[model samples]
Target: MTAGNTGRKRPTISDVARRAGVTKGAVSRALNSGTGVSTGTRERIRLAAVELGWSPSYAARALNGKPLGTIGLVVRRSPEILDFDAFFPSFLSGIESVLSGEEHATVIRFVPDAQTEAATYERLFGDRFVDGFLVTDLRVDDERPAMLHRLGAPAVVVGAPEGSSDLPTITNDAEEAIRGLVRRFADAGHRRIAHVQGDRHMLHALQRRRHWEQAMGEFGLEPGPVEHGGYTIVGGAQATERILARSGDERPTAVFYGSDLMAIGGYSVLGEAGLAIPADVAVAGFDDIPLASFASPPMTTVRSKHRALGSAGARILLDMLKGQAPPLSTVLTGELCIRDSSGDPV
Candidate 1:
């Protein structure tokens, strides 16, 4: 068996140098900075390193105050909640796409609350275990950007939060998209349209709520009941139950959910109540997750490019690592997908 195949110690720089037919100094230069090394020589050294399964030691780099070539992400949510959320996985895939090309890694921490999220960042930064961070799930008056700035930690905020001028931000034009969705509902003759809002603490959820209200006012219609769904299936079901309990004259003819999961939950409750979509209570949801299309009667929703958001944040962070300053803000726009759930023909 080859040295790499054997269950022995990992290959060292010297092994890489021997494999590449280069001096130890040349190997170090190629691995560290590639300065003073020809393109062909650097490629050979990199190939040797890969073939021999040699990678720079993180502990040694930490000791020398060198970059660990990893980005940190602290999400203020439980693992279960994360698993059900469609945006994170797609976003992470985008981040991996960029990091893989640079031979970097991502350190993700899923915390239950803000305190644990803060502590995770502190530990990662104190240990120099990451070169930078990608911050997501922004809140109103978020303190993370300021905290990271104080620590001199380079970070990219995945959502635009207030008082974040010191950091780069990647955001989506969700407000406009939500407005368009509401307008579409109005055009479809949804006069008594209600909204099942996600968590009010989250900026994106609040923005969507505001957009919905604004669109209603613009269309000369009164906003219907606004239920807090907590961005979960159970929450959606509970909220739908409340809506169903309303008197016929007070009931909404259509509902707009903040997330697809909630919409699915709403669908279950609607089905149990024997209500036909669009004919009785039309439905719409946000974050066009994979399951939305396959849902019975399909689902009308906003197709936000969550993966692109992740990729943009990662790209900005990588640029920061390379001593290049990226733009202060980047905004992605999404489209509204009209489906059968909203009374659109199949």
Candidate 2:
């Protein structure tokens, strides 16, 4: 039988050079298209490599202090049992993109809330689990940053960690972003504004709440309507019911929802009430989701820089691991993309 039929191990660069009648350095110059190698020799080396099924030794390259190349993406949220991809695609796409420059890959995991979050690192700190961690969705009084710091693990927090001294953090200015919505509605002559906030325990919701209240008072507007959404579309819709049942004078003329998912709920409930948008009550939300512009008249809302946030966090973590002094916290501004939900500018 011919040798081609046998399951032989692949040849090496040396074998390719030998077959091509060139020195190893000449073969490398040919493969790299360096200036020295003649055109005919380059082609012969390439043919030899192909025939032998030769490949570069990435493991050898990694053995000399060069990273094997992977960044760990750690999410504190619980992993949903469903197979369907949820809100992770956007952020994951972002994380994947930023690491492309360094040829690094992300290993994503969703821990079971705070208790397990603290426990996993305890076991995995030196177990070769990851090069570094990307901590997302930081909560108020979070313990993960301190835990990572104590373990001397490099990490980048997607949201500001609680009581952190120097862990690199990348976060969107949630309060300021939402405050603009409050200001815009008040300036647009809608005084009775309502906010459908998300989970209070989370840092994001807390930031939104603090800003919503402050911005309303800044323009001399009375305390606007407020309700806890628990970050659900259904929860938001039910919260809307409570606002709708209030007295006529107390009824909100405007509403700001925490997320586009919640906005979907608020829009549905408001439509059922026969309330004409802006004519009866205006609505807005955050996280200008892909479907936001498609919602009936579109939506006037704040758009989180989720992709940038994830990308930036990953970059910071890598830098920290490299012994670079990256920013302790990186804050990015968001946009108030005006859509039909808030009505015309007037």
Candidate 3:
């Protein structure tokens, strides 16, 4: 006869310590920064915490006049973008991977415009809701690094190097990957290679476009028609339609999109136009997301380490919070994934 269990109280750090056969101080050191704890003991404490379903309370920390064990991430994008844009999900998962081990929480906020975005940051830091921030989507003439500095808020930028700011950055260098993609197309005898880029306001989008143009010039090929896709599937489709509007010899034989979502959208437009992928026109994209592999003919794209970028950025932020100086910049490499969509994966 088993009793029905209900109204059970939440587990605490004490329970975790008891379960792991360690003292509460050991639990604190293990979860906070592993300062005075051994690796084996830390792992044992973490497993105990997980088993006990115990996580530190940010509210409790705040009440105790301690730094909130919280990390802030404010994304300046429509909420709908989070649904289809694969980068955010993977990046966030990476951040969680590190933060969870440290018993920290992430505060995510979405804003529709720059004004609202800036205000959100101010409010979050000003109110002590978060100890630090993880900034993303580096823009042209970005003001976030300087703004955060003024507020004396610790932060780590998760994108390309910002010449105007000295904040630590975790970036994925995709220039060579983009160039390699272009070279692959050229080697496959593609002369007119077009590109569908994201918003020019974003540094990443601008960088991708630049890489494509430079790679085209390097191959002694005239760059094909270029269009802005806004990093959306619908935008990709519309851009593809415009690209196809060109006359016979001017039309591109291969198209490289700045994102997999755009390339997937381009797929639909190509299908409706009765064009066979890799048979009539080759296709490629950046960010080799899960769907890229499942794409009808599969997609050839650049695999940027979005998860690694997030995890690395989180680590740097944690180090900053601990009064440690992290490197000014950390760059991860991107890989060009060859798939069937790009002319027999050559």
Distance from true position, residue 244, model 3, in Å?
0.5
The residue-level lDDT of candidate 1 at 25 comes to 91
Count of clashes, each model: 0, 0, 0
- Give candidate 3 misplaced runs (Cα > 4 Å): 1-57, 63-65, 344-346
lDDT of each: 0.89, 0.76, 0.90
Q: Which candidate gets the maximum lDDT versus the true structure?
A: 3
Worst 10 residues of 2 by lDDT: 78-87
Between 2 and 3, whose TM-score is larger?
A: 3
Residue pairs with backbone overlap in model 3? none
Error of 3 at 315 (Å): 1.6
lDDT of 3: 0.90
Tell me the TM-score of each prediction against the true structure.
0.92, 0.80, 0.87
**Every model's Cα RMSD, please?**
3.0, 5.6, 3.9
Worst 10 residues of 1 by lDDT: 1-10
Per-residue lDDT of model 2, residues 242-286, tens digit only: 999998788999998887777788888999999988779899988
